[model samples]
Target: MLDAAVFQGLSWNLLDDFRQLFTYPFMVNALEAGTIVAVMAGVTGWFMVLRRQAFAGHTLSVIAFPGAAAAGWAGVPLALGYFGFCGAGALVLAAIAGTRRSLGAESAAIGSLQALALALGFVFVSLSHSILTGLDSLLFGTFLGITRSQVLVLLVVAVATVAVTAFAARPLFFASVDSDVARASGVPVRLLGLGFLLVLGLSVAETSQITGALLVFALLVTPAATAHRLTPRPWLGLTLAVALALAVTWAGLALAYFSIYPVGFYVTSLSFGVYVLVRIVTR
Candidate 1:
C-alpha cells in the first residue's frame, strides 16, 4: 500500500506557506530584490527582444562573470565591475554596429565579444584562484545572501530604468518596427539604437546580479518572449511580460525555499515551460 503516514505528515497549507515566505530577514531581502529585478527585466527585455538584440544582451550577461571575478581579484565592490564592464561592452557593441545596415557586422562583433567574455571569465577565475569562492553563486545565483542595501539599489535602478524606458517607448517602438521609415520620418534612429543598447547593458548587469551570469535570459528574455507570443499589442505585451516575470520569480522563490534545488533551476524551468506553452498556443 502507499505510505499514508507520509502523505498525512506533509500537511500542506497555502496560507501558511505564503505567510512563511517573508518571515525571515533573508527571505524579505531576497523577495524585495527579486521583485525589482523582475520588473526591470520585463521592461528592458521587451525592447531588447523587439530590437532583436538578444545576442548582444547575452554577451553583456556573460561579461558579468568576469566583471565580478575581476572585482573579487582586485578586492572591490562587485557592482562596480558589473556596471563598468557591461557599459563598456555596450559601447563597444554600439560602436561596432553604428547603424542598422551593419547588422551582419554587428552579429560578427557580438559573437567575438561573447567569446572573449567567456575566456576572460576563466582568466579572472584563475587569477583569483582561491579567493573567488562564490563561483557557483556567480554562475547560478543564490538570493539568500542579498542585503537590504542591495535591494534598495535594485529598486532605484528599476525605477530609473522603467522611467527612461517609458519615456522612450514611442520612438523606440517606431524605430524598432521600421528603422528606415522611422529615420525617414525624423526618428533619430541611430541615437535611439545606441541609447537602447546602453540601457540593455545596464539591465543585463543589474539582472545578472540576481539571476546570475548563466540564467539572465530566464528572467530577461523568456517572459518577454512568452508575452510577445501571447499578445500583439505592445502595451498589453509589456504588462503581461512584467506580470509573468513576477509570477515566475515568486513561484521559483517559493519552490526553492521548500526544496533542495537551486532557485535558478526553478526560475529557468518555469520560464522555459511558459515560453513553450505560449509558443504552442500562439501557433
Candidate 2:
C-alpha cells in the first residue's frame, strides 16, 4: 500500500513538471522551434554520418558564424544570412571536393576554407559593434526570446527539408551506401550528392537558430551518431535519432528553466551523455 501511494505521488509530480514546461508562451515557441530543428537535424545528420561528410557538415556550421555575424552587422534577418552563406559555402565545398576526389586534398581544402571563414566571422563581429552583444547566443544558443514568427519559419523550413529528403531517399541512400556501385547501376550519383549537400546546408542553417553555430554538433551529430551506434538499419536508426534529439531538446529546456545555465550547455551535455551511454551499451 505504501509503495503504491509513493508511485502515485511520483507520477503526479512528474506530470506537473511536464505541464510547467508548456505554461509560458516563450516556452511553447521554444519547444516548437526545437522540435522542427531536432527532426531536420536527425534526418540530415543520419545521412551525413553515413556518407562520412561530418567534415562538410562542420564546415557549413563554421560558415554559419560569419553568416549570422554579417546579418547582425547588416541589420538583416539572421536566417537569411545563415541560409545564404551556408548555401554558398556548400557550393564551394562541393565544387572543391568534386574536383579533388582525394581524402588528403579534400581535407586540406576544407580546413583552409574553415580557417578563412573564421577569420571573416571575426571581421564581421568587429565591423558590427553590436555583433558581440549577442555573440554568446550565436555560439551557444538561448531558448529565451523565441518569437512565434521564428517558430513558423522553422515549421516551413522543416516541412520543405523533410519533403525533399523523402523524395530523394531511395537514390540518395543507394549512393550513400555505395556510390561507385550506385552510379554504375544508373543512380544520378553526382546530382544526388549535390542535392544532399544543399539539403544539409538548409538543415544546418535552421539548426543553428536553436543550437547555435559552434554547438550544432550537439543536435546534428550526437543523436545521429548515437542512433547509428544503436542500430544498423536506416529506418530504425532514423527514428531513434529523431527520438533522441527530441528528448534531449525537451530535457535541456526543462533543466535550463530551473537553473542559471544556458540551454545549449544542457542540450549538449544531455546529447553527449546519451551518445556515450549508447556507445558503452553497444560495446
Candidate 3:
C-alpha cells in the first residue's frame, strides 16, 4: 500500500528525519505491521530453514501471486485470496509428505506447484484489469495505505502464530532436527510437520500483504539464514533472526519513507548485506 507517487525527502538533521517517520498514521500502522511480521517470519523461518523447506516456502510465495490476481479479477478482498490459496497450498504440500517427510517428494511437489502457480498468475494478471494499478505493490509491497483494522488483523494472527510456535517448540525442533528419531520417540513428526507448514503458510500470507508476495520470502528466509550462519545454537539463532528481521524491517521502512525506492529493495538489500557480512566474518 505504498504510494508510488509520494517522495518525502529527508532533512539533514538526523533527529528531524527520524521524527518525520511517525508524522503520518499510515507509517505508524506500517511499522506495527512490520514489527509483527518480523517476529512471526523470523521464528517460523528459523524452523523452515532447519527443516530444509525453503523451496516449499518459495512455492507458497509464488502461489500468492495468482491468489492476489484472482482476487482482483473477481473484485474480492486480496487477503482472502492470499490466505485461502496459501493455506490450500500448504495442505497440498503436507499431503505429499504422506506418513513421513521425504526430501525428494517435497522438492518435486514444490517444483510442480511453483510452475503451475506462475502460469496461473500470468493468466490472472492478464484477465484482471484492476490489478495493474496495484501490481507494483502486489509484487514488491508498500507501506502507504495500512489501516488500523489491517494492523489489528496482523496482531491477532501474529499472537496466534507466536503462541502455537511456543507450544510446539520442543517437539518441532526435535522433529526438524531428526524426524526418524523424533518419530521413534513418539513425537508425531508428521503432524508437527503439517502444523508447521500451516503456520508457515499463514506467515507467508500475512507477510505478503505488507511486503509483497515475492519479497516476503526474503523476510522469512534471509534473517534466519543469516542467524544460522552466525550461531549453531538453536535458541541464539532464533533470537538473532528475530532481531535481524526487526532491524531490517524498521530500517527499510524508514529509508523507503525518505527516498524514492521500493521498500522491498531496501529490506532485501539490508538483509542480504547482513547475511554477506556474517558469511565474511564466519569465514
Least lDDT summed over 10 consecutive residues: which range in candidate 2? 2-11
Q: Specify the poorest-scoring 10-residue window by lDDT in model 1.
A: 1-10
lDDT of each: 0.84, 0.88, 0.88
Per-residue lDDT over 1-283 for candidate 1, one digit per residue giving the tens place of the 0 to 100 score: 2223111221378787777777778778888888888998999898888888888889889988899888888898877788888889889888877654567876887898889998998898888876544788788877766878878877887798789889989999999999889999999989888888888888888888877889999999999989888888999999999999999998988787777667888999999999998888878
Question: Candidate 3, residues 1-283: lDDT per residue as tens digits?
Answer: 3455445586789898888888778888999999999999999999999998899998888888889888888888777888898999999888877735567765876799899998998898888866743888888988877789888888998899889998999999999998789999999888898999999999998888878999987699999999999999999999999999999999999998888788888998999999999999999
Per-candidate TM vs. native? 0.93, 0.93, 0.95
Which ranges of candidate 2 are over 4 A from the true structure? Answer: 1-14
Q: Return the lDDT, model 3, position 29.
A: 93
A best-first ranking of the candidates according to their TM-score comes to: 3, 2, 1
User: Per-residue lDDT for 170 in model 2?
Assistant: 86
Judging by TM-score, tell me the better candidate of 1 and 3: 3
Best by TM-score: 3
